[model samples]
Structures are given as C-alpha cells and as structure tokens.
Target chain A: MSALFGRSRSVLSRLVGALVVVLGVVTLTFFLARVVSPDPTNLYVSPQADQATRDQVRAMMGLDKPVLEQYVTYLGQLVRGDLGTSFSTGQPVRDDLLSRLPATLELATYSLIIGTLVGVVVGIVGAVRRGGILDHTGRFVTVAGLALPQFFVGLMLLWIFFVVLGIAPGPVGRLPVGLVDPPQTTGFVVIDALLSGQWAVAGAALQQLALPLITLAFAIFAPIARTVRTAMLEALDADYVRTATAMGLPQRTIHYRYALKNVLLPVLTMLAGVIGFAFSGAVLVEGVFAWPGIGQYALDAIQQSDFAAIQGFVLYAAVLYVVVYLLLDLLYARVDPRVRL
Target chain B: MSVALAEGNLLDVVDYRGGFRGPDGEVTEVLAGVSFGLRRSTLTAVVGETGSGKSLTALSVLGVQPRGFVRTGGRMLFDGEDLFAGGPRSFERVRGNRISLVFQDARAALNPVFTVGHQLIDVCRAHRRLGRKEAEQVVLDMLERVRIPDPLRRMRQYPHEFSGGMAQRVMLAMALVSEPELLVLDEPTTGLDVTIQADIMDLLVELISSSGLTACLITHDLGVVAQTCQDVVVMRSGTVREIATCEELFTAPRDEYTRDLLAASRLVEAR
Candidate 1:
C-alpha cells in the first residue's frame, strides 16, 4: 500500500520540486540575458537610428522598466505561454521552438536508443569477459571515445563521410535545398515523409541524419557503456552472483536474471542523465552537419543574442531534464520496490 | 562417521590442492593438500578461523573455487563418481539437484528485486521437472518445512521484508526445495544474532537429520559445531588438521592447534 502511495507521492514531489528549479532557471536566465553584453536594443535598432527610436523600441519590449519589473513581466508572459519574439527571425519564440524541437527530439531519441543498446550489449560482454582482450579493448575504446570532444568527432565524421569518401549527402540541411519536403504535418521530415509515403524524401533525410545520429550516439555511448561495464563488474562480484553460480544455475540465468537485475538501477540513472548530455552534444553535431534542429536554432539565437529564443531553449532543456529524471525515478521504483518506501 | 567411511562414502576429496595466480603471475596458495570425506546422510562441520580456506575446501568439492584459482591436483568423488573427472555439465547435474549450497548471508544471497517466494520457485523449478504452479507449491511446502510462519504472505515479500532468521529459513527452503542429497552451508548463521543463529541452526539440524540428508557445515562458530554436527573436520592454513567424530574431537583433540582452538572457543562461550 505504501509502495503505491509512495510512488505517486514521489512523482508529485519530484514534479513540484522541478517547478521550483524551472522557476530558478527562468529567473536566472532572464536576468543573465539582460545583464550580458550585446544589448537587445542593439539587435533591434539600426546603427544609424536616433536615441528616440532606440528608447521607443526598448519601451515597446518593456525593457526600460526596472530589472525586477521586467522579470515579473517576463514571468507573467511565460505563464501565458509567451516567450516573446525572436529578434532575428521576428517569429514568436514558442512557435519557433515547437517547430524546431521535433528535429532535435527525433535525433536525440534515435541516438539514445542506438547508444543504449550498443552500450549495454558491449558493456555486458566486456564485463562477463573481464580482464580479457575484449574487456581491455572496450576500456581503451570507451576511454578514447569519452575523452574526444563531440564537435571534433562530428567534424571528423563529416569530413570522412562527405569530403574523403563522397558517399554521404552534402551537409546543407535535412533535405536537398531545392527538393520539396514531404509536408510539415509533423515538423520532422522523416516522420512526415513516411506518413505521406514519400520514401525517397525519407531516405534522403535519413542519409543526412545518419552521420549526426552516429556522432551523437558515440558521444552518449561512451559514458553509458562505461557505466554499465563498471556497474555490471561490481554486481557480478556480489554475493548473490556467487550463490547463483554455486547453485549450478546456468551462466545466462546468473548473468541476466540475477546480476543484470541488480545492475539496472544505477545503469538507468546514468542512462537518464546521458540523454541531456547527448542533446547538448546535438548542438555542435547539428552545426557540423548543417541539420536545422533546435540545437542549431538555439546556436543561431545565441549568436544573434535573440533573448526570447534563448529563454525558450533553456526552458525546454530544463523541462526535458526534469521529465527524464522523474521518469527514471519511476523506473527505479518499478524495478526495486524498496525505492517506493 | 566411521561406519559410513568404511562403506560407500558420499563424498571423498583426496589430497586437494588449489591456488590463485595474480595478474603478475604470482601464485598464492589458498588450499594446500586439504582432504576430507562426507558420510552419506550424516552432518559434518568444518571449523576454522578466518583465512583458513575451510570454505574453499567445501567449494572445491563442488568444483567451483573462485575464478583464477587453479586446481593444483585433486579428486572429488561424489556418490562413487569423480566430479572433476567430467566437465561442468556433470557438476551442473549434481548442483541444485544432487548438492546444494547455502551461504553465510541469506539476504545477500537472494536477489534484491525478487520476492523470496519468486526466487524459491525458480530454484525449485531449475533442476526439477515441474511447471511454475507445481514449483510454487513445492516452495510453499519447503517454507513450511523450514518452520517459517505466514508462508503465503512471506512469499510475496522481498528479502528486506524478512528478518535475519526468516531470511535464513528462506535460504534453507530454497536449498532444500530441489531435494538435494548433500547440503553445503557456508557460515549460514554468521550474520544473525546468537538467539536467531541458534534458532536457525536448530531448524537446519531438525530438517537435515529428519530427511536423512548429508550436509557439510562450514563455520567459525564452535557452538555450531558442538550442537549441530555428528562429525567434525578441523582445518588450519588450507589443510585438514583433524577429522573425527564430534565426541572424539571435543573429548580428545590431538593437535596443539586443535587444543588452542578449543581453548579459544571455550573463552568465547564464557564471554
């Protein structure tokens, strides 16, 4: 009974706690966006504009008021789902985010799925064959993979696949610049193309996505795979494993049913955190591949000092992290009933 | 003990030697020329201090010394057949079917995520030709045989929900669910308090003796040896220092180390 109530209570507390966190992130980013050089008015007005035009533009955005007043107004606007307008694109921030978000979401989701599967399988093999050549080589590869920066890896992949081999599609964007995209029903070309039976468009989009997805997977896979290996190694050394082995239970039973069950909580926690890091890596990867995902959009916004766009990006990222964490905590409770208490 | 030794021995480990090699290839001996035998349907205790490799001696009988530990030379004859003579498949047949092992920490031996009942059912069905429902029934019956109350409710509860005594009872039930001929208990009551330990030991002795099951009890507690075992094997530094009837060992210990152990045991009991 407590486990049932405890599950709901835990989720409620986590969600409520995330509200405070989100508020903090909003307030901090809001103030920081104002304080940072490259004023919002500078982006708005022409260099040759008079002071009157500059003051008028500032007043129009409610930027002439006190910092605290501006913050309050921003919060009020946020409650109404208004992230203000992008200085560069002159579009509502929320709509822009909603449109761009699916691309980053699709990329990160696929990469995480691929990364987690590859990591867990290799991690298990490495751990079960501990101290062997496979384990040693896996350790070396994971260490090198983790140590290398995501941008450098993305650039290398792009260079090899595009410049050296000429097998990959050009890094211009998701689809060929002149080719008509399938439809904007999903905002994601792959999904929209598949839904409309536009196989050619889907194939081309995937071809463009292939390298970035691989790069993102590699970026996330190192941490997740290493964690699985280390956790599995420790779990195999646990007393229960020895007991199972002594019971003459088959190796698969001991490895999968017993050791894997125990190792999954830590692995899940690490896995949940990796998606955030992977999405962040998407920013650089998107730039290298010229993929117009939220990451690239956010980068362009940052470069242009598009305050509203930056706020939405930061807020979107924070919410994603909180949701992932909450989902993982629920998974933890599901796996180990003790967590419910 | 002598009667069964003169007859067909249940298990005979002759001149067993084993050691582990480090990554640097340095060999450190854990068990050196240890030999003992288990009489069919009799309970025996292997008593030793820490680092004595008494537990290793028991493991070697099952052909499962820890990894990286090589068998220097040995023969483990179980039921007239050499266990090491055949491959792991041979041991696999014996394990959980012919011989079962219960460890020191019962809670630690059970997987944390699984209910005691769930694990017991798996252990029951692993070796036996039983469906899930039949296996569950066998587990419930075994839990009762170990004298655990509320077998139905307890089955649905995780290891953390069990008391130390309850957990050991569950361990015993799991070990005995498959009806193995030989039970190897590795300090089965080491983590429990004195009262719970005594209760667990009492339950174990009652179960093993009534069923006429042969068992090897590996423990540092002389009290366990004094109360539960019919025969005793005193181990020191990886070798069997003495093997005798429980009466003979307590009454007339020959080795100086055995005498010292007895003195220490008596002092602990006095405290």
Candidate 2:
C-alpha cells in the first residue's frame, strides 16, 4: 500500500515538473520571438501603409501594451483556453491547430509504427547473425539513415517514386483537390473514411500518405536499430544468458525470451528519443509532400512572422514531449519491476 | 571417500584441450590437457589460482564455454555416457536435467528482469516438463529448502532486491530445483563476506550430506576445502597439479606447487 502511494506521488511530482518545464518554454519562446523579430505591425499591415493604420492594427491585436503587460494578458488568456488568432489564417490559433492535429498525428503514428517494427526486426537479426552479410547490410543502412538529412531524403524519395518512376501520387495535399472528403467526424480523412466505409477515399488517403511516411520512417529508424543492436549484443553476452544456456534451454528460448526481455528497456528509451525526432522531422517531410499538417501550418507561420501561431505550436509540442516522456516512464516501470520501487 | 571413488566416478573429464582462436587464426590454449574426475556422492573442490582454468573446466562440463572458445579435444563421461562424444548437441539432455552449475557471481547469474520464482519455474518446466502450477510449487519448495526467510514473498521479488547472501541462496535454489545428480559450483562464495561464505558453505555441506548428491566446488580458498570438501583437485596454470582425498592433500601434500599454495593460504589464514 505504501509502495502504491509512493508510486502515485512520484507520478504526480513528475507531472508537476513537466508543467513547470512547459511554462518555462512558453515564456522563453514568447520573449525570444519579440526580441528577434521585427514589429508585428509591419508584417500585419504593409510597408506602403501609413503609421496610423499600422498603429490601429497593433492596437486591435493587443500589441499596443507594454511587453510585460501583453505577456501577462497572454498568460491570462491561455488560462481561459484562448490561443489568440493567427494573423496568417484569420482564425483562432487553437481552432487551426485542432483541425490540423489529426493529419500530423496520423502521419506520425504510421511512420513510428513502421519505423519501430523495421528497426527492431533488423536489430535482432543483425545482433543474432553478427558478422553475416545481412548484418553488414543492416549496419550500412542504419548509418546511411542517420547520416542523410530528412529533407534531402524526402526530396530524393519523391524524385525516384513520383517524378522519375511515376509510381506514386504527385506531391499534392492530403487528398486530390477535387475528391470530396468523408464527413469530418475525426478530422483524419483516412480514419474517417474507414469508419464510414468509404473505401476509395480511404485508399486515396493512404496513397497520399505512403511517400511521406517512408521518408520519416527511414530517417528515424537509425537510432532505434543502433541502440537495439548494441543492447542486444550486450544482453546476449550477459551472465544471465549464459546461465540460461547452461540450463538446457533451447538456443531460441535463450535468444528470444531471455535476451529479448532485457533489451526492451533500452529499446524503449531509444524509441522515446526517436519519437521526438520523428515529430520534428515530420515538419520537413510534411513540407516536401505538401501534406496539410501542423508542420506546414507552423512553417507558414514562421515565414509570415506570426508570433501567436508560433507560440501556440511550441506550447503544443512541449506538452506532447512531456506526455511522451511520461508514457515512457510508465513503460519502464512495467518492463522492469525494479523501477516500480 | 576412497570407498566412494572405488564405487566409480560420476563424471570423468579426460585430456580436455580447449582454447580461443584469434581473428588471425592463431590458437591460444587456455585449457591444455586438463584431466579430473568427480566421484559419485562426494564433494570435490577444484582449488587453484585465478588463471588456473578451474572455472573453465566447470563450464566445459555443460558445453557452455564462452563464445570464441573452441574445444579442440575433450571427452566428458557422465555415468559412463560420453557428453562430448556427439559434439555440443550431446549434452542437451544431461545439462540442467542431470548436471547443474551455480556460477561465481550469483546475482549476475540470475536474470534481472524476471522474478526469482519465474526463473525457477522456467527451469522446472524445461527440464521436468512440468506444468505452470506444479513448477511453481516446486520452486516454492526449493526456495524453502535453501532456507530463504519467506519463500512466498521472495518468489515475487526480482534478483536485484536480494542481498548477496540471499541471491546466492536463490542461485542455489535454481540449481537444485531440477534435482540434478551432479552440482558444479564455480567460486560461489568468492565475492561474499567471510561470515556469509561460511554460512553458505555450511548450507552446502548440509544439503550434500542430507541428499547424498555428487558435487564439485571450484574455489581458490584452501580453508573451505579443509572445512567441507571430501576430496581436492589443486590446479595451476591451466593444468591439474595434484588430485587427492582431502585428508591426504592437507597432511601429505605431494606437488611443490600445491605445497606452496597451502603455505600461502596458511600465511593468509594466520594473519
């Protein structure tokens, strides 16, 4: 009972720490955007516009107050769940982000699933076969995956699959412009279509997702596979594995059951880091494919000097990373009983 | 002890030669023609210095030498059955079912991710072909036999939760769960406190005497041999320097190396 209480207390403390971190990130981004960028009024109106019009636009957007007062007002609005309006979109930042989140999530979810599966399988095979030809190839692929930049890989994949071979769909948005999207129940076209049994729409959505998914998965699998291979090599050589071998357990049992369980903690840690990398890399991959996700939204915001949209995006990302790290901690406690203590 | 030897050996390791092959294809022989025998129903101690191949010979009994170690020549006979005659696969039935090994670092030898009960249950299922409930029962009983304070509570605990002495007992429980005929212990108490080492040695002696099981103890400590072992095999530099009944080894040492080792141990003990 005390252990249970202790565990809950630890989780609560971790959540409090995460909130503090998110708050720090928000304040730092707010100040940094103000310090580095030009006056919002210049971008909001125009160079040709008179000073009176620019001042009116700044006052309308609540930028006429002192910087500290504006910051206090921003935090006050955030407490009431208002993210202000995006100058570029002419809509609430919250609404714009909520509408686009599903697209980014769908792409990220698929890419992470494919990347983790391939990385783990490749890692296990490479570790088990050690000096074999397949292991050498896997090693080379992982090194290359880590070395090449995400955008270059994205463009190259697009060139090969879409432009050169003509085997893939064009770098258009989520669906072809004319196709009627399924009813916006989930905001994710593929899932919504699947739910409503719209097979062709679903197929089209998946077809559009394929190349961008490949680009992100390819770039993110390297660290996962590398960490797994290293952990597995050490696990296979551990004394416990030797004990299992000496106990007349079959080689397969020793490898998969004994050695694999020990590899899980390290793999999970690496996956947490890889998940963060993939989300950031999705920004680049999404731009290349022109997928209408938050990455493209934020990219536009950055280009237009939309401070409110940028701040909102950073806040969402910080919360997401905190949640992911929290999940990883829970998984750690699950995999290793010692962690529960 | 001589009478037990006359009844016949339980395990006979004859002219075993093993080594590691480097990347350049040269062999570094770590065990050179090492020969020893364990008589039935006796506690034999293989005492030697650090690099004397005592642990290697113990590992060789189960055909589980570390990776890169090539056994160029060896014929291990257990109950008149050749263990290495059919190559590595030949020991599949004999290891853990008939012969069990308890390693030097007891905590490290137990899987960290699994509960003590889970790991022992696996051993039971693998060797005895028992179902889950039966294997679990055997594990609980075996844990009790090893004198653990609370077998039921300890069963659910991971290896790291146990202290050095308790972990060694857990390792002993794992080794004895299968009721093997031959139990090989490799420096089982080397890293333990002196009082804990004596306690473990006492538990081992009691277990052996009560069950009449054949056993081998691999250690560098002569005092442990003098206290508990029935026979002694003193090794030096990958070769057996002397093999004798415990009484003879202490009172009538033959090899100069053995005498030197005895004197060295005596000096340490006197200090």
Candidate 3:
C-alpha cells in the first residue's frame, strides 16, 4: 500500500512538473513575442488604414491594457483551453492546432517507429559481427547518415526520386490538391481514411508521405544506430553477458536476451532526446514536403507575426516533450528493476 | 603428474597456452603451458598472485574467455575428450552441463535486469530440458539449499536488491542447480565481508562434501586453501610452480615461492 502511494505521489509530482514547464514556455514566448516586434497591430493593419482602425484593433486585442493584465487574461483563457486567435487565419489558435497536430504526429510517429526498428537491428548485427565487413559498412553508413544535413538529404532524395527519376510524387501537400479530405475524426488523413474505409485516399496519403518520412527517419535513425552500437559493445563485454555464456545458453540467447536487455534503458533514454529533435526538425521536413502539418502552420505564423499562434505552438511542444520524457521514465522503471527500488 | 595417475582425473589440462592478442595481431602469452589435473570428488585450489593467470585459466576451460584472448596451443581434456579439438560445440556440451563456474563480484556477474529466479530457471532449463514448473521447482530447491530465506519471494527480486553475500549465494545456487560434475570457483569470496566470506566457504564445503562434486578453487588465500582444499597447485608468472597434496605443501613446502606465499599469509594471519 505504501508503494502504491509512493508511485501515485511520484506521478502527481511529474504532472505538476510538466504543467510548470508548459507555463514557463507560455510566459517566455508571450513576453519575447511582445518585446521583439515593433507592434503587432502594424503587421495586421495596413499603413493605408486610418488611426481609428489601428486603435480599434489594439483595443480588441487587449493591447491597450497593461502587460500584466494581458498576461493574466491570457492565463485565464489558457485554463479554459483557449489559445486566442491567429491574426492570419482569424481562427482560434487551439482549433488550428487541433486540425494540424495529427499530421505532424503521424509523420513523427511513423518515422520514430521505422528508425528504431532499423537502428536496433543494424546495431545488434554490427556488435555481433564486430570488426567484420558488415560492421565496418554499417558504421560508415550510419556516420554518413548522421553527418549529412536533414534538409539537404530531403532535397537530394527529392531530386533523385521525383525530379530526375520521376518515381515518387512531387513535393505537394499530404494529399492531391483536389482530393476531398475524409471526415476529420482524428484529423490524421491516413488513419481517418482507413477508418472511413477510404483505401485509395489512405494509399495516396502514404505515397505523399514517403520522401519526408525517409528524410526524417534517416536523420533520427543514424544517431539511434550509433548510440545502440556503442551501448551494445559495452553490454556485450559486461560480466553478466559472460555469465550467461558460461551457463551454456545459446549464442543467440546470450547476445539478444542478456546483452540486449541491458542496453534497452540507455537506448530508450536516447530516444526521448531524439523525439524532441524530431519535433523541431519537423518544421523543415514539413516545409520541404509541403505537408499540411503544424510545422507549416508554425512557419506561416512566424512569417505573418502571429504572436498568439507562435506562443501556442511553443507551449504545445514543451508539453509534448515533458510527456514523452515522463513516459520514458516509467518505461525505464519497467525495464530496469533497480529503478523501481 | 604421471599419465597412470592422471587416468583417474576428471579434467587434465595439458600444456595449455593462451594469451591476449595485440591490436597489431601479435600474441602476448599469459598462460604458458600451464598443466594441471583434477581428481574426482576432490577439491583442488590453484593459488596465485593478481597477474598470475589463474582466473584466465578457469575461463579458458569454459570457452568463455574474454575477447581478444587467443589460444596459441593447448589441450583441455575433460573425461579424456580434448575440448579444444572438438571446438565450441564440445565446450557447449560441457559448460553448465558437466561443469559450472562461479566468479568473484557475484552482483556484477548476475544480470541486473532479470529476476534471480528467472536466471536460475534458465540455467536449470538449459541443461535438463525441464518444463517451466519443474524448472521453477529446481530453482526453489537450489535457492533453499543455499539457505536463502523465503525462496519464493526472494527469487522475484533483482540482483541489486540482494546484499553482496546474498548475491554470491544466489550465484552458487545458479551453478549448483545444473548438477554439473565439476564446479570451478574463482575467488568467490573476494570483496565479501570476512564473516560473510566464512559463511560462503562453509556453504561451499558442505555442498561439495554432500554432493560428491569434484571442484577446483582459484584463489590467492592460503588460509582458505588450508581449511577447504585437499590439493594445491601453486602458480606464478603463467606457470605452475608446485603441485602437491595440501598436507605435503603445508608441511614440507617443496617450492621457494609456495613457502614464501605461506609465510606471507601466515604473517597476515598472525598480525
């Protein structure tokens, strides 16, 4: 019972910590947006517009009030789940994020899954065949993959597959421009299409996703494979691995079950950091692919000086990172029993 | 050792040579033609200094030597079968089936991720082809034999949860659960408290006598040798300097090095 209470208390503390981080991001972004610009109203209002129009816009945005008052008001609205309105689209920022978040998440999630699978397999193979040809080749490829810039890789892949070879789809949006979207249940085009039994639309969605997915997955998997290889090498030399081998366990069992289990926690912790990098990299990937995700939304907001939208995006990302790290900690406790005690 | 006398031995390591390979492929030999024999149902101690290659010799027999170690020329014969000639397959058949090894730093030797029971069950299942239930029973029985309190609950705990002495007991339980014909203990009491060391040594002696298991102990502790082992192989600088019955070595002291080792240990004991 005490253990149960302790666990719940820890979870509560983590949740509180996550909220604090989100709040800090919100406050910082708010002031930075306010301080960096000349005036938000000038970006919205034309020079041709009269002084009356500018004054009305400023009052409507609560800019006429004190900064502290505006902050308190913003905080109050955030508590009710409102992110104010975007100046460019004139839509609530929350609604805009809700529409686009699924695309970003779908792209990031698929990339992470693919990256982790390929990386782990390549890592284990390299470790097992250490100093052999395959090991050397794997190390070279992963190092190259990590060294190349993500945007350049995306452009190069596009040049080869789309522009020159004409094998892949063009750098269009998530689907063909004229294709009507499936009902926005979860907002993810592929998943919603699949749910609504729209196989062709889902297939088209995946086809459009191919290059960006490859670009992002390559960027993510390179670091993962390198880290896993190093960790596996160390784990393979651990005394426990020797003990397992001495027990006459099969070679495969010793390598995978004993040595691999020891490296999982470290790999998982690295993945949390990788996911954060992926989220930030999504902005460039989304721009390259012209995918209708929050990365594009964020880019447009920044160009248009939509302060509310920018603030919301930063806050959303902060919350996401905190949640991802929290989940990984729980997983660590599961994988390494020492963590539980 | 004469061939006629070695005929009754369970393991006859003849002129075994092994060493670590350099990065440029040169071999720096550490165990140069070290030979020994283990008679059935007798406890033999290989006493040596820190750099004397005793632990490497034990690891060589199991075919689990650390990476980069090259076997230049050797023959490790178990029950008259040349293990080196038969390759890894032969070592696989012998390890944890006919022979088991226990090392120092038991906590580091047990995988921290696995429950103690899980590790023991794997050892039991590997050699005997037992079902899950039978394997669990075997593990519990061995844990009980090792005098671990509350075998059922304790088995579910991880290695880090156990004290150092408890971990050693668990390691012993793991080795013994297979019912191997030979047990090689490599400084199994080092790093443990002196009192805990005594307890583990006593348990080892009891287990060896009760099961009639032929055993080899590798340690630098002469006191442990005098108390538990019946025969002694004194090693220095990658070679055996002396081999005698424990009584003969303690009473007559054939080699200068053996006599010096005894004197040093005795001085420590007296102090």
Judged by DockQ cut-offs, the docking class of candidate 2 is medium
TM-score of chain A of 3: 0.93
lDDT of 3 by residue, B174-268 (tens): 89988999999999999999999999999999999999999999998898998899999999988998999998988888889988998888833
List model 2 lDDT by residue over A137-243, tens digit each.
99999999999988899899889988999888998978977888899887778999999999999999888988989888887688888988999999999999999
Residue pair clashes in candidate 2: none
Native-to-model Cα distance after best TM-score fit, residue B263 in candidate 1, in Å? 1.6
* DockQ by candidate, in order: 0.62, 0.74, 0.80
- TM-score of B-chain for each predicted structure, in order: 0.94, 0.95, 0.96
**What C-alpha RMSD separates each model from the true structure?**
2.5, 2.6, 2.2
Residue A26's lDDT within candidate 3 is: 88
Question: TM per model?
Answer: 0.95, 0.95, 0.95
Q: Per-residue error at A261 for model 2, in Å? A: 1.6
Candidate 1 on A177-293: residue-level lDDT in tens? Answer: 777888778677899999999998899889988998898898788887899999899999887787777776778888998889988988999988888766643788888877778
Stretches of model 2 off by over 4 angstroms after superposition: A279-281, B1-7, B267-271
- Interface RMSD of the predictions, in order shown? 1.5, 1.0, 0.8
Candidates' lDDT values, in order? 0.84, 0.88, 0.89
Candidate 1, B127-198: lDDT as tens digits: 888999888888888988998998999999999988888888888888898889999998899989999888
lDDT of 3: 0.89
CAPRI tier for the interface of model 1: medium
In terms of docking quality, how is candidate 3 classified? high
